[model samples]
Target: MIVIVDYGAGNLTSVQRAVSYLGYESLITNEPEKIVNAERIIFPGVGAAGSAMEEMKARGIDDALEKAFKSGIPMLGICVGCQIIMDGSEENDAVCLGLIKGTARAFPSGMKEENGILLKVPHMGWNGLNVVQPHPLFNGVGKEDEFYFVHSYFPEPLDRNNVFGVTEYGVEFVSAVGLKNLFATQFHLEKSGKPGLLILKNFCIWEP
Candidate 1:
């Protein structure tokens, strides 16, 4: 069974629906045992990193997630869930899960394009991905495939080797990252269309 961490910060229903649509069973819970024992884990989140961390810690889910990762269970984090996996986040001056060595940086202020068009703060729209390194999760995914993104901050992996894909808004940022049993994306796969579903399917079949 796939366990979707319900830390009160994610779109649990939509994520569960997406997994179910792909013909897999999933459980959304903050229970540590259920999460640690699941065949796979989907850590999907939206909202501020600070509050999310608080919720995770309050329920002892943070330790459970670390334990789950150490146990070699394949796991995926989406959006803010992805951000918290890093060392820290600019959002709330938060110290995150540190599952990966990185920092989540907010998009710069006074951001403008080469053509002098002012860009929006929260990049809320479809964006194309530039695959940096080949990985099984992106096996059938095309470089031209677009995923829906809604975030002002993006992860910057301390080790560039962990970056699997990059996307650009005002600048190029780490949009997807993978290390051993862990995989994460800045985009919301549940909100994305065909290409997104394809990614979910790939995750279900991935061995590690």
Candidate 2:
């Protein structure tokens, strides 16, 4: 069964609904055993990194996820879920899952557009990805397709090769990352409409 992990972060229901809409059944649970046994896992969240990590640890979900990853199960992360998979996050000065060798960084202050308009933090809107490398999660996804984003911090992998896609919001930032069995996106595929659904569908059937 596909498992949507719940570690007390928000946005669980929406991710569940998106999977259901794609004709795949999923369970939302905080149970680490369920997560470790899940055929596929979706770790999606919207909240502060510190509390999210705290909850996961308190429930032992953190160790379970690490075990699942090592078992070679296909896994996907979204938003804060994507962020905390890195080594650490500037969001709450919190150490993260370290699933990927990277850190999440806040968008620099005083970011501006070419037209001199100051860009907003929490970059809440639509943006297209400049896909740097092809991966199954992006099968059939194209250059023109835009995804929904809502974040102030972005993942920066220590190894540039881990970066799958990028998006510009004053500065270019890593928007998608992949390493072996794990893949994640900074944008919320659940909220990105058809294009987003396409990625979710791809993940549901992806082998790696």
Candidate 3:
């Protein structure tokens, strides 16, 4: 069974709903045992990183996730879920899961477009990805496909090879990353429509 982790960060239902639409069974829970035992895991969240990590630790979900990752389970992380998989987050200066060697940094101020329009924080809305490395999660995904994004911070993996995709807002930022059995995206695949669904489908069947 696939487990959609719930650490009180919200966004669990939407992820579960999307996975169900793809004809896969999933459970949304904060139960550590369930998470560790899940065949596949989806860690999706929308909220502050410090609070989320606090909840995970309070419920022992942090250890569960680490154990699951080491067991070679295929895992996917979305949004804040993606961010906290790294070493730390500038959001509340919270230390993270360390699944990937990186830090989640806030977007710099004074962002601007080529036309001189000041870009906004939270970088909300649709953006296209520039795939930098080949990965099965992006199988059949095309250049024209745009994904939904809603964030002020983006991940910066310490190892460039861990980056799979990049997207531009005001500056180019790492939008997707993976390492061994785990993969993550700064964009919300659940909200990205068909292209997003395709990635979900790929993850459901992904071997690594």
Q: Give the TM-score of candidate 2.
A: 0.99
Rank candidates, lDDT, best first.
3, 2, 1
Error of 1 at 55 (Å): 0.2
Give the Cα-based TM-score of candidate 1 against the true structure: 0.98
Whose TM-score is higher: candidate 1's or candidate 2's? 2
Give me the displacement of residue 31 in model 3, in angstroms.
Answer: 0.6
lDDT of 3 by residue, 102-124 (tens): 99999999999999999999899
The local distance difference test score of each candidate is: 0.93, 0.95, 0.95
Q: Candidate 3: what lDDT? A: 0.95
For residues 1-208, write the lDDT of model 2, one tens digit per residue: 8999999888989999999999999999999999999999999998889999999999999999999999999999999988999999998899999999989999999999999999999899999999999999999998899999999999999999999999999999999998999999999999999999999999999997
Alpha-carbon runs more than 4 Å astray in model 1: none
Clashing pairs in 2: none
TM-score computed on alpha carbons, candidate 3: 0.99
